[model samples]
Target: MTEPQGALLVGSVNYDDAEKTMRTASAVLGGRLRRIPDGEVGKRFHWIMFQPDVLGQAEGIERVGDEPRWRRDVDARPLRIADGVDAATLQLPPLGYASAAEDSYEIFRRLRDEGAIAEGIRFQVSLPSPVAVISSYFSSDDRAAIDPIYTAAMRRELDRILAAIPHDDLAIQWDVASELGIIERASGYGRTMESWWPGDPFDGLVERLAALVDAVPAGVEVGVHLCYGDAGEKHFIEPKDTATLVRFANAVITASARELTWLHLPVPIDRDDPAYFAPLTDLTETAELYLGLVHREDGVEGARRRIAAASAVVTRFGVATECGIGRAPAGTTEGILATHAEVASAW
Candidate 1:
């Protein structure tokens, strides 16, 4: 099988759904913590490897785009614990999380190096927002200070790492959870419609993004993967018009990246209608749009109609599932990719 080149999912790192692929992987994830983190507090990503189908491309999800209201189960605990540190303290590597994160990345690194996914397919890496993590655990000042320090530090480390990597094949992404309206609500950070969710500690989110965008060494391109909330239900505040996209997406578009991937629900606009993304109708003219047209069971007919409908609104099209397939069964993800390729061909 040949590799797909035009902006398919490089791979999914964090699964929005809490479900893990195996009991062993789940045990490995659960083993890291001495105590569980609150549903509201944040945690790091699993080094989970998404088994790739050579004929497919993946989609992006913010984190958990659904399942937020499931009353916190006794079994479902938070991913980390209080370490008695201020927001700055939150940065000192959790009792066991960060080290595991690094170790986990090893599986992903090997897959890319060995061409397990797609030989020439572009691959990318991601992590949650340091600011979001700080805000979830500490106050605003602590959040402000922590993201910058981490941003500067991570930028330095990635500079060397990216330089050493084969940029033609690899890329990096910073998945900022602060912007995801649902996760923020659980963590008590921000709302969906508020222009700038007060106490919205992500002010540094933008700055850190800019710094990293500028600092990424040549040959490596950077992009952002944004999600509305952990799950479909978290998108509070009815989307009245395209203003939310105008406001939130503007900052992202102007930042140092060249790509913007968003979840697109099905709409009634005419397939021939000029008002394609009548909601995000006012997107800026710089980055590309990976119209999310697939979900757990969406099919080729539905996929083709919707993708064509969306492309009419904004052109630089890419076929994608509603979100990542990391938590979805490897077989389920395989079907999603097969459909994505079929739809892309139709477009």
Candidate 2:
């Protein structure tokens, strides 16, 4: 039987603690997973805004209105600017990225040293693109003004990660979920991702992401995770096919100065049809392609169907969950990891 060349863990692993997440995933998947994340453990999943909270407390920044609640997200009430702050004149503080990266790296190194994790696997750090955070927190008017500052702040976090972690053992994956809403022009679930750029939305998004991809140094491995929002275990909008993903990937590939190490695209559980994978033919990047074909509901059988369909168009690929399994019910993580092992031969 034909098997996938590798397997990817799309950042989160749904564990309450980081140590358990690393040890468990390494044992089950072995060398198949080239990188492992901390399951986005503790407060990360819904609390992605914690990083922005650092900026909200800066000297010139003030909360304009009562924190506005995102549509339908009961727990999400994010800080907005009190009055317009000049984007050019703003002096925002460090967004607590270095501290966080250092803390996580400690755990990563411990596992590797103890022989829990195989040598040569990277400790993957998944970060949301600044646009995703801006779209989630800021009002439509504030997105453009806030974007540059936030992007710079996020880059500072990357700088810390680069300086602290060994380049060979690090992989940075940028999560690009919100950009899809803008590209598809779909009002994702209850929120609207206002496009701040003037020209074609696709061009704007590609430029934004390409700049981010280029920001990483050459020695460190970097990849992009293209997602349609994963909330309530459903996509914010179901992708009609892979055409949009292919377009975005191709543009980024052409525009980026540095080579991307991998590209991860989510596959909806029901999409086993070959047309869904057809647009992949236009892709010519040497980066490994990992399809989010493993679903908690269908396990190995469903993954095989999706893999077979994808193989018809693209000869080389890997396997992963459509999004992080952090939000999945706690007990299901091992089964999901086992499914990936069952469906794909590890790299």
Candidate 3:
């Protein structure tokens, strides 16, 4: 089969700043990357969970964690705690998605004008799915109650982003990690992702994700990053195969009203067997499929092996690392970027 057509940066590049991320990635990958992130600096790896803490400090919600919730080390603030309290009466203040996005837009515009970034590439903004944040921070009873509220709050953040940035130059990527935990029924970090929904967990997940996709305006590019988890650069649970991911991707694609620009799924370093990619035959979405099969350990040669295996099951695809490389050890960024350039030809 022909070599993979392109490469994608699944957010969070390991760089000192956004300028370096845009300039360096554009120089190396050039037109291969359809979108580029702001490198998710300052907050490190929290992603959108930082919104809640920002909201907690805002007017409406109260910050209640003297000690970490559930004895786990996290920076989340639960909006409700007592069982008898009313969830409906509460409304969180806006999470300031517009401000953050517009701030980045300034940098993006200057870079594009200065030829640091190629024309036609969208500025990709990756937001954590609502389920990921609600499950991580809120108690079980509080999760269902707070989910709608949090979901609405998050949509408002999206609204801000969409309104501020030019739709033609923007792409919104919903990062779906915790939902994978729910799918696999995986237990880790001293908690289990038991399905609280009355019916199939998959149904609940698809519904939530579809709503997220539809919330973005029609003119903008949108995508879903079907992540397992990225803590310590390892999945919360290694997928037995691609079966669950295939099911999830197909479900969301069929249910979504808007066109999906792309769908990304992680491929474990050790899983190059055709069995791991066999289920991909069932994926029928027109969105670009980016296999997160690149690994810094084995670099280009290893990525080529994984890509060869994936090619057996699909006619076409792109390449990426299993997850964001920001958490990767310092000083390894150049090698990782070079691996992408080496493994895949530019689009």
Candidate 4:
């Protein structure tokens, strides 16, 4: 037996298409977009927003004499985190999306109706992780106040969005890389296990995320894509792992969703190859994992060897690009996605 086809090895498709495309939606478009000048979102922060003694740079909250740390607006609601060259990173609408969630669902439905997605492909609809949204726009100075607001806003948006879609046809993969494995240590965010970066407040971030997943309607398949920092292709960071990830995977099984997608790099860590998916062993038995076997750097031969190597360790596994194609050139993104399908199809 082989892994299923008709299965989609989907990665995060930015939310830009969700909103920009909405302008054309007769049913979704409400109020005049022109009323909100495009220049508003273009504004940038002039001062470093938040910095801590640990991460030295304060996790983007620090500032120089006069420059702003980030260019985020306290109130601007962006659909994605930021539109990178590859994908539109999305966020929950700032002002409650009373109807936009439904509208977003409708848009995806039409795509399927139009047969735009390949035949028999399963979808892992990408939604921004709530933690990333709050941290990005809201200054670290007031994250306590910002978190509640963010959660409420996201809950309403997801509640309606999940309600609108058919659970079986569409899958949900919340894009969150905040506490992804051992990456936190790279920035000096935390020095010991007892204390987490910034503060112990974010200690339960995974728990909160798990709750969000469990809160999803019983029908939609929910997946969690966890990775280290995703700044850019050649980001100034190294790789590492954490016991926390294993704990989260164990708890994730209780959630209502069917699948849990994990992002595993194809490269080696300290010359130690990821020959076996030891992490999957700790995950709940209920969900299936989409092993990220293909690399943005791989060719056909590399892909074949990777498939064989990854399959050797996985039983109930699917295939996908190591991570989102955001920032990767279009050609790289296409190759990464297409290669995954081709390799998976052969099985």
Top-scoring candidate (lDDT): 2
User: What TM-score, computed on C-alpha atoms, does each candidate reach?
Assistant: 0.58, 0.93, 0.92, 0.63
lDDT by residue (tens digit), candidate 1, 1-347: 11111323423523332222212221332221111111111232221111011001212101222332222221111122223434343333222223333343444355436543323433344544444443443332433444444444455446555645566654555554445443234333342322123454345345555555555555665555554433332333323434444555566557744443322222221232334456555666543455555554556666666655565555565545444444454456446555655555321
TM-score of 4: 0.63
Q: Candidate 3, residues 1-347: lDDT per residue as tens digits?
A: 54987888888888867888878888888878999888766554545556556656544455556754431233655554444558776767766556667787889899999988889989988888888877876666777877888788888889888888999999998899999999888985578886566898889999989989999888899988988898778889999889999999889888998889999999999987878999999986666889999988888888888888898999789999878888788899889988898878888
Better of 3 and 4 by lDDT: 3
| Clashes (candidate 4) | 23
State candidate 3's TM-score. 0.92
Q: 133-183 in candidate 4: lDDT tens per residue?
A: 445443433445446545666677666656665656555666555544322
Residue-wise lDDT of candidate 2 within 116-198, one digit each (tens)?
99888898988888888887767766777878878888898888889999898889999999899888777764666558868
Q: Candidate 2 — which residues are off by over 4 angstroms?
A: 47-52, 59-75, 89-91, 189-191
Prediction-by-prediction clash tally: 13, 3, 0, 23
Q: Comparing 3 and 4 by TM-score, which wins? A: 3
- Candidate 3 displacement at residue 244 in angstroms: 0.8
- Candidate ordering by TM-score (highest first): 2, 3, 4, 1
Better model by TM-score: candidate 1 vs candidate 4? 4
